[model samples]
Target: MLIGAVVLVLGSLFLVVPFLLGNTGVTGFVIGFIASLIPLTVVLLTVRLIDRWEPEPKRLLWFAFTWGAAVSIAGTLLIQPLFALAAPTSSEEAFTYFMATVQAPIVEEFTKSLGLLVLILAARKYFDGPVDGVVFAFTIAAGFAFTENILYFGREIASSNDPGTDLVRIFILRGVMSPFAHAVFTGTTGLIMGFAARKWHSGYAVLAFFIGLLPAMFLHNRWNSMGQNFLVEYFVVQVPIFLVAAVGIILLRVAEGKLTRQRLLEYARAGWFTPAEVEMLATSRGRRQAIRWASSRGRGRAMKSFIKGATALAFTRQRILSGRDVHVHQHDELELLRKIPTLRAAVLQ
Candidate 1:
């Protein structure tokens, strides 16, 4: 109820803000949408592919995106002006520095990370691990960045000079040069949030949240600060962050693969899964081959659904083993079980 109320208030503000600024135009929207979407597609695909074993629910994923674009952005718009008013600045440079390096990063990263927090609070089941948290983080960042780009483009369009040059420049900066900045920054928060979720009873969720928030803010600060040459910023600052994120994601993927393998073996031993099915489901390659074999017989959809259902069942059972609430998922567990026979019938033909 709280999340819904927040969303309602913020979404309304998000819709109304443009009209107040007189910046609502089709051209700006189009340009921003195209610019933001191209990179977002790549980010989404990369995130999804990384979590090959168990994909998150699409509805929840979309909610995270919407929360970022509407609620987070709305909060930022409302809070930032207050911050500007509160911040003491002797000159324009000081004001700019205050806004960019301090206020913006704190406000924006917290707001963006709030989307993941909402998910954790409202729908903990969707977030099983670090990969799921990263997925939500990237999606939320994408949505936030998309709306920001639109606002920037709109302002550029309203500029007195030729808007085309401004549009291209803004696109190159926001869309190309630093497309993943928000994602990378906020993903640090997501990583820690995932840890908090996994270890919810460890009496350290508060500590984890702050630990994540600090790095996110620091990274955002360094990126916003114009204290270095452009090439130095790119090579010295950006590349290492990107490599660290890449390495972290790869490590998480391997961990998830091992978890899947362990779960499948456990289920096979318990008679819930056949050894053949367990072996096939333990690896990405084997899963793909299973799908291909079913596709060759025109049962691709059924086989795919079956595989997904089996995977969910394994994860669900693991959750039960971990003493998480299982009653809420009773229906889902039964449904997946129901699909297994139909999936087999369709695929075995």
Candidate 2:
């Protein structure tokens, strides 16, 4: 409740204030939306696909994105300037470097990450493992990037003598090459939080956050500190980091697959699931087959929902077995249970 209220207030302020100030004209607004929409759509779809086996709630995903685009950006706007005022600088270039390398990494990463941490504190059940963490992290980063793109696109087009060429160039640089940069950084933190959520007690979640956050900040610093050759920085640093993040994501996916099978087996032992259902839940190919079978009877959505809810239920039960949460777990279990019967009947029919 508190988290939702905070996000609602901050997001409204950030979204409305610029418009009231006449900072963004329609042309700049249109350009920004077009510039961000393509990449945002692509990234969102990709992340959703990765999480297809066990989808997080759509509402929470939107909340993460909203928090990032509106709340986090607003908070960064207020906080970074304070650090600039406090620091001594030799030249504009030096100060620019200071803001980019030091202030940005600290402020932006924390701002982007705070949403996930809050969700972890407020609604830990959404996260079954690293994939959930990574998905939320990527969604929030995508939101931040979208809003930042809007502001940058608006400002650049408004200021430039040749808006056409400059806008295209900026779009190519930020939209194409660097779309996933923010996601990868904050995702590092999210991955650790997911691990803490899965394995360790709630008490360790904070320590896990720092462990993830430090790397995110360091990487953000490295990228920001690099000199003016965008291509050089991208190839030398950005690409490598992206590759590492990709490998990490793949590993997490594999881990989720294993965890799913293990959790389903526990359910099987409790007589809640069958071996066939366990196998279907465990493998991507089997899941596709199950979907196809359900679709033949016009119940694909129900089957999908059943699979997703069952996955969440399994993870929640796993967390309970580990001796952690109770009330949230019980609440989530009941909610999932209530919605799943119709789906189960559809699939069975």
Candidate 3:
């Protein structure tokens, strides 16, 4: 937590410096910053819905967002300029196109992905599966997009003769139309790392990160390359792809819920949880009903804790069954098992 706090502070410095030094006036900056929040809120609510089955730790989620908004953006700002210093002189238009299509995708996706790598390394236990990966990826990407949108919006507002018109146009294009652009790119990496977390060692998980980058970079490249035909291509190509990805994510979420139930059932057989308790813990409706019951008895908070612990316990059992890092998961399994009864007692009290 201390390390995360320090990183966030340093990243905040990186984030603020550009805005402070930019040509955008205070008014433009403030407007852009406020506008950026609209999309950020939308993206976060969507992530929350997807993560409803088993939420990642709040601290880790915050770290991921900070890493994207601050650290990843900082890295991109620092590194992309070096390419200009090294490149041969070219027409300004040509250079801009090259930077957008080639340089930006590679640098931004890679920097964004570093946050996932950090999570896999530092908080392996929570890095459970593809849904978790998508959640973290979307969060980090949302942060990056929020910062990027501010830059774009502020610059447009500052430079344009018609600030109001341009602001609305840009907001409609970016905030309304393509808010998930960054999330989709980085989510590819997160999804792969999530699969790696299930069965692979840390070394393999790292490799999976690189492997995932291929598709992420590809999609970003294609998106950037579509300059003139963006609207048509967006509707024809990107929309379909987004729909397919959404369907896949839905299936993965369903699978995760089923996996939770399956693992908890093992515990039920061993007398850790009653069959009814497993039913209550595994299903969304069951959980809501349980919480309502507990709330009536003034133990809503305790019920939530019990449900959370049981969910974590189910995943820990999954890690044990997978036969990778057994010792580590064994410790987690025992700890979760020990705490669960207490949580249940609290819920019932």
- Tell me the TM-score of model 3: 0.90
TM accuracy, model 2 = 0.89
lDDT of residue 269 for candidate 2: 88
Over 4 Å off, model 3: 1-12, 85-90, 288-302, 346-349
* C-alpha lDDT values of all predictions: 0.76, 0.80, 0.86
Q: Which of 1 and 3 is ahead in lDDT?
A: 3
Worst 10 residues of 2 by lDDT: 15-24
Name every residue pair that clashes in candidate 2.
Answer: none
List model 1 lDDT by residue over 299-344, tens digit each: 8887777777777877776676666566756666777777767776
Q: Which is the leading candidate under TM-score?
A: 3
Return the clash pairs for model 3, or none.
none
Q: What is the alpha-carbon lDDT for the whole of candidate 1?
A: 0.76
Which candidate wins on lDDT? 3
Question: Cα deviation in Å at residue 79, candidate 2?
Answer: 1.1
* Candidate 1 Cα errors over 4 Å, as ranges: 2-10, 13-26, 51-53, 201-207, 329-334
